[model samples]
Target: MSRHLLIETQGPWAGRECASFVRDAAALAGGGHRTQLLLLQEGVLGAVPGVLPELDGYLAADGDLLVDRYSVAQRGLKQEQLVAGSRLVDMDEIAGNVLDAAVKVVWH
Candidate 1:
């Protein structure tokens, strides 16, 4: 069975929390569980390429991750500004992914 992890990043606290989750999740991927990260609100800032430390490690894994378009727009991010592999998905997709995951980690 494939396991899924959902990370809900929504506020100031999420800046550090989401990054840690990405790092930890990437490390854990070798064990077989799939990880997905969702960034909403201020958390969208983390989606910006090159801003976070050791981002290459997380990107190398290519896990399923989504950033809220509404949130990104509110924060002044366009699709062109995103990290090379990041996707700007709709809210419905984000919510549904969260519901489908085995673990939902929320950083608020």
Candidate 2:
């Protein structure tokens, strides 16, 4: 299976597309692809519980959810406030993934 790096920088509050994008990622993972959803900037808001219900399905399908540490601090979000299994990562990690030849990067 191929790997996909789906980078989301906006939250559902920004528009209706965020939730759809997450669902797409979940579908990809459910289809046996290695899909990772990286939430950065205002996208971290989606990491909050109940913000994006699609997150649960995404995680259940073995999709990885990565939240930006800097964004969390900048927005004053607590560690416990994020969704379960969500990983707090640095830019270095994002950079590494984005640079990986096996990863297909998509920013939304």
| Candidate 2 structure quality by residue, lDDT tens digits, 1-108 | 899999999888988899999999999999999999999999999999999999999999999999999999999998899999999999999999999999999999
lDDT of 1 by residue, 41-103 (tens): 777777777666444676677666577899899877798887777778897876676576465
lDDT for residue 14 in candidate 2, whole number 0-100? 89
| Total clashing pairs for each candidate | 0, 0
Worst 10 residues of 2 by lDDT: 10-19
lDDT of each: 0.66, 0.96
Residue 43 lDDT (model 2): 98
* Candidate 1 residue pairs that clash: none
Which has the greatest lDDT?
2
lDDT of 2 at 84: 98
Clashing pairs for model 2 are none
